[model samples]
Target: MSHPQAKIHRMSELVEPIATVTFSEVPNEAFLALGMRDYWDGYFAGRAAPLGQAPAEVVHAVFYNFADGEVARHIPWVWGKITPQEAIAVRERGTAAALRQLLGPLVGSPGLVRAADLATRAAVSAPTEGRALYAGLRTLDVPEDPVARLWHAATLLREHRGDGHNAALLAHGIGGTQAHVLMALSLGMKAEEFGRVHHLPRARLATVVDGLRGRGLVNADGGFTDAGREVKERIETLTDELAAPPYDVLSADELDELTAGLEPIAAAARGHDD
Candidate 1:
């Protein structure tokens, strides 16, 4: 039988993305055990299964694919009807506490703990940035052809460079729209492709393309114009500047020591999936 703690970790990873997308249904005990079936059936009723892939897919996408393993799959689902901001705050507190407990000698050192605190805060506050990045992408130079312009804008919009969440966090300091666009671009999307991923309605997507083209962010064919490239580069630079350095202020040995205990917890949480 799986350890009780391992099961709790899996359940926790499952809850966030469901919450992230604003799932109206609240997660409960059953949801934590057999997955979303119980929760969705109770809340979404008959229409729950088709809620865009199983909860596992979405969870895997977030924990493994999107965040690139920054968030462990084992952390328990946070209970309570809380806003994203509140959720982030709660997570940060927990992370800080955990680090202090697990890696006290290193994390408690001057500057390191402060950096860790800031990094956690930035990550938890990503959705705000998502909105900002989306907006910034709207201002790129327009191209002659309408379709080309749309494509151009679309490519910039979906850039998921370092990670979409990171882009979103950076967006908090910038604009959501800009962050969304950067996320699109980093993911290597064209304008039309972005529409599919974001599920933009036909009329709305078309209008956005037109508007971006008008603002010089895209070409008639829906691709980034020259100005769009400059905007993308600028956003990337800013994102790098704002992001926390890996292991900030910690010596290599210190970081390794810290990771030794934390890694097992992470492995146990992720079921050894790396």
Candidate 2:
């Protein structure tokens, strides 16, 4: 059997698509209805809403992955268009719509209800210390609707793990741009592809790559050196350990049920994306 931490990690991965479909896959109209300019604006506003009118620098610090100036472009500006509470409402509604479209009849099924219950229990049990995003999200009430409740639970767990991941990256002394480069290498993504996604200019990306090479974390060919691979593994392991405590509230059988219930839902969401 997998360690409880490993099982929790697997379940979190399965829940990600449900938790984040509104970020990219949801229609632009959902955001536009909130008086936002575009999806990027909605992205920044919705994700940061829990932080309650946070400035770009704060978002940059907590989000810990976007390129410099990326957060600034959308934040404060997005706040001008819509308040944080309103943005949260739109995000929740959009997520429910997307999940319904993907999940169909499974939205209210017993399996989904059981999974939501287990996930919510774990999320509520998670520690808030050192987890800024999750801590803020915990302030909001869980939605009453079943599909919305499931999405809410998944979002809580997602942010909990994300907060832990950022802490691990910080401990390893990785900066935002550098973290992207390492992630690309770890996931076998092209530098150009990942760089573009993060709004990293070619020159800036080259500088980050050169710095990683200086630290013996990257090779001349832009792949991970032995040290780089070791660092990445260590970071991931630490993140998983940090994320484990929440699921400690669940027993072995409950963890298995959560995974089983979410697997098909994740598959359906992935299938829709494909």
lDDT scores of the candidates, listed in order: 0.36, 0.85
Clashing pairs in 2: none
Q: Of the candidates shown, which would achieve the greatest TM-score relative to the real structure?
A: 2
Q: Which stretches of candidate 1 lie over 4 Å from their true place?
A: 1-178, 195-197, 245-248, 251-274
TM-score of each: 0.35, 0.95
Model 1 residue 149 distance off true place after TM-score fit, in angstroms: 45
TM-score of decoy 2: 0.95
lDDT of 1 by residue, 249-269 (tens): 344444344334234333322
